[model samples]
Target: MPRERVIFLVDVQSFFASIEKTADRSLQHKPIVVAGDPERRSGVILAACPLAKQWGIETAEALWEAQQKCPGVTVVKPHMQKYIEISVQLTAIMESFSDLVEPYSIDEQFIDLTPTLHLFGGSPYQAARLLQHKIQQEIGVYARIGIGPNKVLAKMACDNFAKKNKEGIAHISYDTLPATLWPLPVRSLFGVGSRMSRHLERMGIRTIGQLAQTPVERLRKKWGINGERLWLTANGIDESPVSPRSHDEQKAIGHHMTLPRDYETLEQIKVILLELSEEVGRRARRKGYVGDTVSVGVRGARFDLPTGFHRQTKLTEKTNDGLDVFKAAFDLFCTHWDGEPIRSAGVALSGLEPDHCRQLSLFNFETTLKKERLSKAVDHIKNKYGAAAILRAASLTAAGQARDRAQKIGGHYK
Candidate 1:
């Protein structure tokens, strides 16, 4: 018979805020939050420390709202690069404990400790405590640990039990699921969001225990495979492995940005579109992939009324060139744009394949070759010097966002 698997999901507490506090000792005891600048249309709370949480400051709330909630709260701008570096260090720490380590997100990771638990006194709780201590000593961050036989249970144990507990560690098993997890509301389950929870409640499945008891056939009929998956999750069954390469496969590559203010003219909106397309193309080239499908998405400034469209077009040839991507995206925007003031725009590429060779056009063979060579040279220069080392003349115009975007990671200042 095979032995049970031991998986742990570790989450850093107030990740961004914690890092800021660790860097500056003076802010250790004060209520602090990491937020984006208000003038940039990114004035949202990204992370809040425990002290800040006491005043009901929550992530995703506007920075102004958080200040109103806690008048003395200290707001800090996010440093995405620093946070990413610390995440890499945390990954290295986990790799020392187990060979199977998977980063679930910037602040959460899963490590399979089944084989290495014996080295840590054969106690999952004690092993968690030691791991927590090591992270606290080396990185100065508190990590909550959830131990279970599968990833779902581990995640639940961490989010629902461990995070609320004083010891910062919790465990769940098949035998204890009835008492530990079933009493919780169905919405509290891992994948059950507000809509799913409402649906489950309407079906008289208000608690995790009720959802678990519902017949699989009924759920399968309602949501197809997703419903069955949710039922399995409620029953504490997950077979997905903690693979490190889970994020390597790419179905699509896209970049989206929220503008600082409304862009009313076609010329201004097209500039942002070209910049996004260029970014998407650059990423595809870096990954050595060529895509034949281009998509454009636009959202209007007015939230009260519906005014946006997402459209895609297929090209005759696959390419990783920024100019080619921009041309395709520009065509899509011209066709679908409704002349409304756009507040956000995005570009994406799909239908991808390896860029091992290019299909040379019969009429434009020389031109294609020259463009490819030029792109290669530009990529080389940008890589060696910096992304801003070379730029299109349009990028320097008032309508362009490349210069400002270059200083940020994921729409936040780095």
Candidate 2:
């Protein structure tokens, strides 16, 4: 039997800038480009308010380009601490409606409203509308919400309803999906990215209806398991649930980054590693967790196409300390250097458990004490002031850009 489920996909509008304007009334209705300084040519454009978008500025655009397009744009560096504080509060608010709120990302979440609609004393439509009003009124950020029988459908509905106005809510069911959804382009479905869209276009499948009608075996032959999944999505047949648990369960924690420039020198690479270590360590401490494994990834410079080293490593013990993670990460980098010019690198920590889960190693015991105290101090400063209150030297450049761009500094190092 199909269990009744109503997933609420809530997406904050112009998240970073919106939050900033929400906090300070003075910035409202002003052209706001949250990003780094145009001088350094550093930092990606993170978010833009409606006014900035009108000037052709957008997230991930170069700050210089944004300035050229919109001379009056105001760049504001990110406030990671503020975003987190607001996220915590918003999550609490969402939880009040149901215990099954799953944060899909920093700016969005999925909620299971199946069981609680009756208690709210109305139809799901009424409940959803009320929820939207509550979030906008309480959080000071307008959000687009979609309701459907499953998570994926709800997500699509949210995207469909996210047009110019707060026509802000959409509900989709299998019975009405053909008219409401199938008319949209194939790209409207979740799994179809640029590459997939090109492939589908080649096959004369330009619409969701065409993709849905394609034979499953034909899809599997071309795109493997993902093709079959795509076919299902085209038919409005998403069975995924609005899980309270995150997808992070099987893995503890991991981080990856793309470099703006390639590096050949060991010193330059070491600086990058130190920055990554600081991130892994901070997240571990924030969650009261530690990991027994530390792994690093490298991508070689690609003149023709992007490429490089990708590898992992096991550690001697679990640790939440940046120094230890950095040491292990550096050791792996040296092992894999192969005299190649590195383009990008990343670090990850797995085998996580609560800090008190295991005993410290004899070699690590003494050093762990010092690391703990230092980490706590850093965390306190970051928690109170902002993520920039403490950072490794390598991060200063990016942090400065973040300040200019108006991103939440210290975003989960995804």
Candidate 3:
């Protein structure tokens, strides 16, 4: 039998919010909001569960406003390390179902479930429900799955499931398109943002059915090439594949940590920068990759503060040595920061290529070899003991704090 292609769009339900609930059983049924403190300039809500939505709370809203809407809303701090750890495990679980899993983000993925559907008794719904139950049981989080003929409709169905129902799985086939997809608002389409929605409204196009039938010329005149793509997606005509173990567009490998409290001393922030650089370098070497551009991001007390800064500098050599990354970050900090209190910091590397294939000057070959040997030795010791087994004096002060934060997520390298 010729197998029919089926795209599965899987999304973690209220990811950050759900993680908080998992950690504390008391938080499971109550309305929860995940965000930074409103007192600081970083008081932005990042994620909220459906329970919070009932009280008019939403992601990206001001924390203060969200509190006003839902006075009993419990606020939880962001623990990205823990979230990423869970994400890594979740990704592995998805890959176990089939090799054709594409990570859409930290909390979402698309899987090609076409060939394997028959193994689960020739029913897409049965496979989807089974997957959903497995994820919920293993990860302690709810995930809604959407199964469709293509990726776009599957994604749309996922979004629709999140907003309208909690069936744990939603299916959208061509036969049920009119009943399931036609009444959806055009704004519900993936590419439709605020400005795009206004443009669509102005054209008197208000529904997915209308968009599917709108003249291509009129759409192209308004949105150019993007308009044509949207039209196809609205009509469930997306042809993109769900590639499982595909090549990634990785320009760099980096890791960053945000502090629970701000530091007023330059010495404190410098120590943090070095730790972050070490993390980024370690990941780079693990993947046998190196990059020439190193970037630093610093968050101040508030958005209006001039101290909030981001700076990137090119490295003198293509390397993943911790010292090289630290040098770049130090240069960046010296130029952009003025010893203002630092709330958070992150480091990244870009302009990446395979380490073995990277171009290197003949004169620096010996120096590079020495650095690589030293890095390997350090990694061996840390891998055997812990990340804090051997740390430079510069990062000693911030080591304890960093470990404590990463512990919340049970740190896993992806």
Which candidate tops lDDT?
Answer: 1
Per model, how many backbone clashes are there?
0, 17, 2
Candidate 3 wrong stretches, greater than 4 Å: 1-4, 37-43, 245-248, 254-276, 295-316, 328-347, 358-364, 382-389, 396-414
Best of the two (2, 3) by TM-score: 3
Candidate 2 per-residue C-alpha lDDT over 189-296 given as tens digits, one digit per residue, 9 for 90 to 100: 887899889889999999888888899899999878988999988988876667776644646566665555677788778877877777788888887789978889
**Candidate numbers sorted by TM-score from highest down:** 1, 3, 2
Tell me the tens digit of each residue's lDDT in model 1 across 309-383: 999999998888888999999998999888999988999999988788766668877876788789889889988
Top candidate by TM-score: 1
Task: For each candidate, give its TM-score against the true structure.
Answer: 0.89, 0.78, 0.80
For candidate 3, the per-residue lDDT at 73 reads 91
What is the model-wide C-alpha lDDT for candidate 1?
0.92
TM-score of 3: 0.80
Model 1 misplaced stretches (Cα beyond 4 Å): 115-122, 194-206, 221-224, 264-266, 301-306, 338-341, 356-373
Residues 1-414 of candidate 3: C-alpha lDDT, one tens digit per residue: 334578899999889899889999998899999886454467788899779989999899999899999999988888877888898899888877777899888899999878777776578888888888889899999888988889888898888864357576888887787788878888888888888877888888888888888998888887789999988887888778887645476866777666777777777877888888888888888878899999999888655765678889997778898879988898898888876787778899999988879876899888888888999999888778877677777654653355543333323221
Where does the lowest 10-residue lDDT sum fall in candidate 3? 405-414
lDDT order of candidates, top first: 1, 3, 2
For model 3, what is the C-alpha lDDT against the true structure? Answer: 0.81
Per-residue error at 121 for model 3, in Å? 1.5
